[model samples]
Target: MAETDVISIDAAQQLATAALIANRTAPDIAARVASALVASEAAGQPGHGLSRVPSYSAQAQSGKVDGFARPSLERVTGSLVRVDGAFGFAYPALDLALDALPEMARGNGIAMAAVRRSHHFGQGGLHCERLADQGLVALVFGNAPKSIAPWGAKEPLFGTNPIAFAAPVPGSASLVIDLAVSRVAKGKIMAAEKAGRPIPEGWALDRDGNPTTDAAAAMEGTMLPIGDAKGAALAMMVEVMAAALVGSSFGFEASGLFSGEGDPPNLGQTIIAIDPGLSSGGTYGERIAALMTAMAGAEGARLPGSRRIGARLKAEREGMEVPRLILDEVRKLAGGQSLSRLD
Candidate 1:
């Protein structure tokens, strides 16, 4: 197993950005992606954290990822925008979307962003949370490489697509909802495999369609949906919004992200931002707070994303723990000899 150790947030981002730069990724793009990865790590999301560095480096070096690609934005008249990622990392494109969303939502009461030719969007909710901080409710959907099969199918068709939403609470932390339609994210299986651990049996099935606990076999198979048919349908809905509506490749047409092979995944993401005051006459925040207050009053009731918010806060104050082996690999990839971590 990889030895676990603590590393400061700054060190995590720095080494991650350095490794990407060493692999020929543009500095700005690398910084954006590295920041997102670090945020995921700090939020207690290991599946989308430093474990991605090695694969990203290999993809960048092998031309499976266009390290120097730039995202471009176009206004689709009023209230709508489209950002093309140029088949690079998704962070730059998502950043462009976030930058353009607030002003449009403020003026038009609603706005939508369509991002195409993108790579993986590390944490889907983080993007929506940005809009929430700007006083807008945001819904975000992203399509990834195929991993989950549709309901009643043995063959994989739809991606383990994710959808996230966030709403501002006026004074406190925003309410955020993020979920992968699959039983769990495919990256968690990948993480378990890397850490030499087995996954839970219900998470995925073997290639022959039997449920398995072996992470390796799970990776080669299909991920079960969260709510049987319901989750599968939701995954397809997001797939259409993110891929078909955005003119990106479908999940079945995309290449695998695990290996440096085929064309770039060319995924798609769609974001919707709505000004709550537009319809609620500025009382939306208080209305939602009432429901939250009632829910919190119930015995043993915990809100969604509470743990993630707390985890992020603690990581900010106490730093993050990453595997030492992962850090060594990152340093080696970056051609750096230092392996020091700050307290």
Candidate 2:
């Protein structure tokens, strides 16, 4: 195994921020990206955490992502909001949507925001969790570069789309559910490839439709969906909600997110926030608590997000141990040394 280095949460954030700034990202934008990446790291999602900095910095420096672009918000209706990322990182666009959603949902009982021209938004659950923290329910849908094939086909057509839901529970952390349609996220395969490890069988197929343990081949091929045909159908649903409905590029139309040679991904994300108090007549808290109690009461049963919550708490209390190679790469980027490509 590769050597590892320990880093506190604050230090990790600072390092990531410096790396982005060195690669031409504005200070404010770099900070937002760093915060999201570090939070993902703390939550035990390494694929969406520090591992993304190299590619992100490369894209910013290459103009594939507009490092200095500012996102704009448009209130399409009383409860409908639209945000244009302007081909920038997705964090600022998502921030604007989250900031506007609470007031609109409370007033209208429910509200939705559609985001377009954005890049990857790490850990959709985090976005929904924010709304849940404010006593509102939230759902987030996002599309990525093509990676999964439609059922019964070798050619890839859909991304490993993700869906996340979060609901408030009185006197406790919110219930959060987040999952990628694929059997595993593409980032995991990328990580394995970077580590020179082979993936387990059934996770993906080679370009010729043969199952393979090679991580590099899997990246050039198709990711198996979570529930076979059922998962593919879910990915299609997300593609419509996040891309078609939002007027953004389809998964097949987007370029690789790991490389800096192509045009912007122009991805899309849709977030919906609902005011539980208005919908449930103020009984939401009690009802949710009862449901939580029943679920927790079951033998050998664990609540959703339990593992992630534990990981976050442990990271906060004891810092994180990051791979030494990844830390070195980040440090080099922070010093203004541009990499031609991360893939």
Candidate 3:
């Protein structure tokens, strides 16, 4: 393991608070946003951890991301809703969708929501897990700036385009699955680049269209999808649902969330919530729980959400481990000092 420096969650929150305050964001917004990031790290997703704080702070300060923006909702039908993120981070808008989904699902047996003009949301699975915890099954899809190449093509044409699903399970954490359609996430590439490490073979192609492990070159090139054509096809489906269906920017047309572009990324996300009871005649939870029990009873099969939930519990009890470089950067940013590390 790398030499990990552990810090209490409170310390992480304090650092996030200081950084956001230094950037002039409202205290409440700062705390909420910081808590999200901290929660991601505590849940073992370092790709969406403190590494993103500086970028978020910069985006807020530069007006690319509106710290005070609130989502506006429009009911398209009894079972469908549309949300405008108002050029803000995706969490708040997604929260709105979650709030509306239960009532809509109860009324209609299913609910669907589409959101546009949002920023990067760390993990779609988190949202689905929340719904699953509330006795609903959920599927979510999100699209971002183009970073992946289509099958047999060299240039980038689609974003990583993540999809997530969650279902309720008794006596265990919800069964949640979240993965990038690409072989790896762009954030993973960025992390490898920052650590001066080579990515694995098959994850990306070089600018010249040859496979490469060099993170910097891979960033300049394109990512291949998992399972070759199958994953690419899934990514295309996500693009259609999250971008085309929502009338939002698609692929390369979307603004880069991390590049500090003045324009909003014009991100799009789609969520589907289903009240299982409506389908299973009120025994939905018990049936789903029984299914999970049977699956877990199989040899060597662990629950879907076990790893992440375990990571979160461990972090809560033992604190989270952050990289030294990230810690130093956060300290510098929080202290109102510029650092050469990011440069």
Candidate 1 vs candidate 3, TM-score winner: 1
User: Model 3: per-residue lDDT, tens digit, 16-113?
Assistant: 76786677566666677787888878888777778787778888888888887878899999999999999877888888899999999988999999
How high is each candidate's TM-score?
A: 0.96, 0.96, 0.92
How do all the candidates rank in terms of lDDT, highest first?
2, 1, 3
lDDT of 3: 0.82
Q: Mind sharing the TM-score for model 2?
A: 0.96
Per-residue lDDT of model 1, residues 147-259, tens digit only: 88889889999999989999998778889988899999898888788777889879999999999999999999899999999998998998899999999988898887877
**Model 2 agreement with the true structure over 26-75: per-residue lDDT tens digits:** 98899899999999989988878898999999999999999999999999
Which residue pairs collide, candidate 1? Answer: none
TM-score of 1: 0.96
In model 2, how large is the Cα lDDT of residue 99?
100
Give me the runs in candidate 1 sitting further than 4 Å from their true place: 337-343
Worst 10 residues of 2 by lDDT: 334-343
TM-score of decoy 3? 0.92
Q: Candidate 3, which segments miss by more than 4 Å at Cα?
A: 1-3, 336-343
